[model samples]
Every structure is written in structure tokens, then in C-alpha cells.
Target: MKKTTLLLAGLLLVSQLGMAEMKKDVKFTEKTYGVCSREMSVEVVDGKIASFSAVRGCPGNLNALSKLLPGMEVERVIDLLDDNYCSGAPLAGYTSCMDNLVEMLKYHVMGEGEGHIQEIRKNQKAGRKVVAFNGHICSGCGLCNAQLS
Candidate 1:
């Protein structure tokens, strides 16, 4: 009982420290790419996309993505679209400009030293609450059980 209580206390402290480490300064970054959009700039505020723009690419698609990016968290954007390729398009060996922009943000704005996942791992190594929650189905609906399996 004593050990369990100590472990829970340690986890709570680690969780708070992880949250503190995530508070980073706002930043802006720009980069030039080889494909569709030749260049782009991204602004990050409080770990969310403040704004973004691209040059020399599909006007409609690029513009749409540019508008959608604002207010979305940068890490969420990277998880949803990184490495996504153009489907059935004439441009061979082409990936979406959105993906490229996400890449730029991850590598440039977020910095090469520590990415979102890496930070979680680093914190866990130092005893952070890397997995904060777990769920169980009371009625045995099987959805959560299937996912776990």
C-alpha cells in the first residue's frame, strides 16, 4: 500500500513537469521545397498553428489547407497527414503540399532536437505519466476490447 501511494504521487509530479516543459515560446519558420509549393512560412503560437502560406502550388488545394491550418495543433496536423501522397493525380512521385508544410513545421519550427513524441519519451525516462489513462467497458460492448486486442 505504501509503495503504490508513493508511485502514484511520483506519477502526478511527473505529469505536472511534462506539462511545464511543453510551454515553449512562439516562433515562425520558413523553408523552400523541391516540389509543388516552392516555399512556405509557418507561424506557431502556444503549440498551435497561428497561420501558414505557400508559394507556387495548387491554388485551390493550397489555399484550402492554409485556411484550415489555423487554430489546429501542429502535432495533430503532423499525425494526420505526414507522408500522405497525391492519389490518382498526374504529378508522379508527388506528395501533398500540406504534408510538406507539416514536415517543415515539425523539423524547422518544432526544432530537430526534440519532437512531440520524443519529448514524451524523454519525460517518461525521467518518470513522467506517459500513459495517463486506461478504459474498460462495464457492459462489455466489445469495441474497446477489440481495439485493445
Candidate 2:
């Protein structure tokens, strides 16, 4: 019983130490690609920042994330959308709907690297349309103008 108690106490102490290692002044780099928010939370842990989960969409949660990131080390931030997802017009409505909201998203990404930003464009005359990141459009989706408006 004593041995078990000692082991348990050791584990608890280690857990507390691990939790204390997360730094509050960690720096995060945010990037937006295809309606996904990619944020790289960087912090030094045991002389290096340990790896963590990839960033997805964070809606109105920037402050919370920023607070959590100070001590947490995030190695990567990736957007999950691919050419196939865009080609099917799955994001058409979102893109069109986001036109008016681009400014808001831009401000969010710029002011705080905390969430995903997506943009979509359709050009019937060119027989091609693209959903893009910032200004670089990629992947053509079938027409879905009504959904965007």
C-alpha cells in the first residue's frame, strides 16, 4: 500500500510539473487557406516546444486560444480543404456568402492569428471558377451562385 501511494504521488507531481511547463508568452503564427484557420503556437518546453494538434476554425475564440497558447507549443496549422472539396462546389455558398465578410475575416486574421478564412470566386465566362486562399484561387467548383448570395 505504501509503495502504491508513493507511485501515485510521483505521478501526480509529474503531471503538475508538465502542466506548469506550458508558457503564457508563447508566440503563434496564423495562416488562412481554404476556409481553415492554421495557427502555429510556439513555446519553449524543456528547451523546445512540444508538438500539438493542428488548428481548425476558431470562431470568436481568439482570446481563449491566445491565452492557452502562451505556454503550449503548436508545431503546425493546416487547412483541410483540398482540390476535390472545392471542385464539387461544396464551399460555393460559403464563398459567396463570405464576400461581404472578407473584410471581417481579414481583420480577424490580421489582428489576431486565431481562425480560418475562406474565399470563393466564380467566372462563367472563363469556364472556370476557383475557391482560393487570399488572392490565389485554386480548385474549381460547379456553379452555386445562389448559395453565395
Candidate 3:
């Protein structure tokens, strides 16, 4: 039964479009906390990684992400992502990242009250780009940069 289930899962994954190709330099990471799955890849141009992407799902948007991150330094990109997305690991080992993301989301909602991310969502809805970190949008809102004496 276990083998059958495994086989079926493999088949299902294979059936997914755009997954058959071997993805180059694809990295995966998972924390021991929750089920957050992050896949990242650095795009290379002129012998350097030009950009990066942290996406949910094992083989997500590889092509699009590669195109988007066209000039990022590999090490620097990995360092930036490590703080939130974590380091390389297998797809089955992403519990920690999931836990971290969930906890972060929870804390922001608790600290700032419900709908703390609502402003970012609103901006996104209005076709504005929203940059968020740890579930909080760093919109120069002064909420984060405010001096806490």
C-alpha cells in the first residue's frame, strides 16, 4: 500500500506540466516547525547570479523566477533569503520554514491587530507593489522604524 501511494504521488508529480525538465541550481529548504515549502534559483548573467525568487511549491515558476532575477550575486541572494526562506533541504523537510512563516504572520496579526497586512493587500489590489518582511510591510510606515524607548 505504501509503495502504491508513493508511486501514485510520483506519477501525479510527473503529470504536472513543466516539471519533467531538470531544473538547474534549484534549491529547496524546509524548517522543522511547519510545512512551508520554498524553492529558489539564482539567475546568472555575465558569470554572476543576477536575481532570486522565493516561491512556495517545489518546482514553482522556475522559468519566470530565473528571468526575474537576472543579475543577483549568488551568495548575497542566498544570504538575504536565509533569514526568511531558509537554506537548502528536501521537499519533505520544510516544516521549519512553514513554522517560521506562520509564527511571523501570527505575531504581526497579534501585535498590530487583525488585518495588519490589510494595507499591503489594499495596495496590491490597487496595482501597487508591496514589499513585506516578516508579515509586515515596510512601507516607511514609521511603525517599525519608530524609536522604542
Candidate 4:
């Protein structure tokens, strides 16, 4: 499932429709905290990531994320990285690039209190846990911990 989502995101990133029109754009800057990645700036054009910049994070990993992120749909990128952890392990008990990006999109790109994420919120409020697994590889951490944040 992770592979499929990643593949789809990669394909969506390079869509011809997105590539054809680069003028229409939206820029959003999200501040990340309690983690290695401190800040991120994302520019979307035609519903796809056109440019990405990160502040105060791992150069190699952040560089790769920046490269692979552009040309991907905002939603798909969120799906791919929603549960990603820094170095693929629990660290600082905070979100990684993917999770922070989702938070940003949930409010900015997707709009406040809107879209399918609202459903997730509803379910979570109803005692359901909204989880994103990296192919079910559990990190043995409380991702669904309500006390977090």
C-alpha cells in the first residue's frame, strides 16, 4: 500500500496538466516544532507541488524529500508522508515532514474544517483512532496518544 501510494504520488507529481500550467500558484509556510525539521515552505501550482524548501533539518533526507515532493499532488503527498518519522524511528515524540505537511494542508491547501480529514476528526472524536502505517511496521510508540500536542 505504501509503495502504491508513493507510486501514485510520484505519477501525480509529474502530471501533464500540472506541468502545463505553472502560473497559478499558492504559497504556504508552515512552522514545525518539537522535531528536527523546524520549518517548511511549500508552493503549489495547478494542485501539484512545484517547489519545496525546509529549514534546519537533515540535509540528505530533506533534500531527497524536496526533490521527490515537487510534481506530486498535495493530497497524495500527505497520504505518503502522513505517518512518516524522522529516520523512520520515534524521535522527539513529534511529527516528521509528512505529518507536518498534512497539518499545513489540512488548514491551508484543503481549507479549515473541510474535506475527508474532517471525517477523520469526527471519527477520532467518536473514539476512533486515525492511523497511517508504513505498511504496518509499528514503531511501538503511541501514535494515537491523545496526550500528545
Candidate 5:
């Protein structure tokens, strides 16, 4: 019984230390592709989302997400929004603003998915036309218009 108690305490301490190592008190911003939202920002505090906002998108849905996402663990938010889709349109790459948020979190906060993000940024920096979906550049595209209509 004494050995069991000591083992449990040690495990708890180790878990707490691990949690302490998590990213916190940082803000991340990313430009989204193939979505109505032009950009998104997330603020994380103590390994949880402190706030989230998008520049422009479905106001109602984005507002709802803005309210709902705060206080959620970063990993949990990623899990919830991963592979989320909107409009199901080929031009949109079958991805939604929420999925973009997930990608932002994965790349910035969790240090995952950095390659794709870095590549996109690199192309943009070089003034090379970056195609977001299906060999199409998103600028002035009528695809979003079609989805809206």
C-alpha cells in the first residue's frame, strides 16, 4: 500500500511537470485559404484557447465559434476542428475556416504541420503565385461568389 501511494504521487508530479512545459500566453495569426475568412488569430493561455477571431467569414458561425472555443484545451480544439469542411466545393478544397484554425493551431502552437505553412509563406514571400486549390489562385476568383450565390 505504501509503495502504491508513492508511485501514484510520483506519476502525478510527472504529469504536472509535463503540463507545465506546454505552450502558453502566445498569440498566433494565419492567413486562410479557400475560405471566406481572410485571416484568423488565436490567443492561447496556459495551454488553452483564451480567444479566437477571424477577419471575415460567416458572421453567425464565426461568432459562435469565437464564443465557444475559448477556455478549450489547444489539443482538444485541434481534435474538434480537424478535417472540418464547408460548402463541399472543389475550389474551397473541401475545407472550412474552422479547419484553417486547426491548421494554425497545429503549426503555431503544437509545432505540427509547419512544413506546409512554411512553404506557403515562402512562396508568398517570393511573389510566386500560390495556388490554394486545384491549380487555382484564390485572388479575384469567382468560386467563392458561386458558393455564396
Candidate 6:
């Protein structure tokens, strides 16, 4: 009887430990600018991407990204996608859908980087163009200097 009781207690302790180690999934969504995609969504589990999707972007490329990004660490995705540029569209303002995804992951998921995401959202709401790079407002052009000042 004592041995059976001890075995039951051990099983309970193991179950509790398993529950403690399980991480909750987090979902994040953001609107993107200067790219074909209008919005993006990500699901993170255990600090890695569980799923990804983009709305209104290049179908083939976005589909590929959606498949490849899952199971990758959030920081690794940011590192790989940052600074991606698309020159085909002059109105893209030197940003691509992938770069915008990096921004979303940095600001929303990992909680790193400056407030470039907020600034971009504000400017987008006001129907203005915002150029950003590496979490800073782009100072290379004078168009957005007023915001800096």
C-alpha cells in the first residue's frame, strides 16, 4: 500500500511539472505600410513561431513565408527579415512586406526596438508617409523631418 501511494504521488508531481513547463501561445496582429500586404498575424509558442499569415500581399512569396516562418525562433526571424527591400514599387518607401513583418515581430512579439511601430501607425492614420529603418525614423530624407522635430 505504501509503495502504491508513493507511485501515485510521483505521478502527480510529474504532471504538475509538465504543466509548469508548458508555455502559452501568444497571438499578434499588425497593419503594414509601404508594402503590398495590408496586415499580418503571428502566433508564437515557446518563443518560436507557431504560425504566420499575411493579408493582401504577394501570394506566392507570402505563402512561402507563412510556411517557412513557423517553428523558427522569433529573434531569428527578425534577424533574417530585417532590412528587406522592394524596389519595384517606388511608393514602398524602401520597405518590403518582409521588413514590415520584422518590425511587427520586434515591436509586438519580442517587445524590443524603439516605438517605430506606433509612429508608423500614427502616420498611417494621418494619411502620411513614414520611412523607418532599424527602429528609427529615417533621417536620410527630409520628408518626415517635421515629425522628428
**What's the true lDDT of residue 47 in model 5?**
87
Q: If scored against the real structure, what TM-score would every candidate get?
A: 0.54, 0.23, 0.23, 0.54, 0.62, 0.60
- Model number with the top TM-score: 5
Alpha-carbon runs more than 4 Å astray in model 5: 1-22, 88-90, 115-149
**Any runs in candidate 1 off by more than 4 Å, and if so which?**
5-25, 87-94, 109-149
Error of 5 at 10 (Å): 18
lDDT of 6 at 90: 27
Worst 10 residues of 2 by lDDT: 75-84
- Candidate 2 residues 116-149, lDDT tens each? 3423332322445444444544454544323221
Candidate 1 on 39-98: residue-level lDDT in tens? 676777878888878777778987888899899887888888776655432222233565
**What C-alpha lDDT does candidate 2 achieve relative to the native structure?**
0.36
Query: Clash totals for all models, in order?
Result: 0, 6, 16, 2, 0, 0
Model 5 C-alpha RMSD vs. true structure (Å) is 8.7
Model 6 regions lying over 4 Å from their true place: 1-25, 114-149
The lDDT of each candidate is: 0.56, 0.36, 0.38, 0.61, 0.69, 0.69
lDDT by residue (tens digit), candidate 6, 94-139: 5678877777776666555554455444444455555454466653
- Rank ordering of all candidates by TM-score, starting from the highest: 5, 6, 4, 1, 2, 3
What overall lDDT, based on C-alpha atoms, would model 4 receive against the true structure?
0.61
Candidate 4, residues 8-122, lDDT tens digits: the string is 9889887854543323367978666334667789898988889888887778888998899889987788787776545442222235656666766665676544432343334
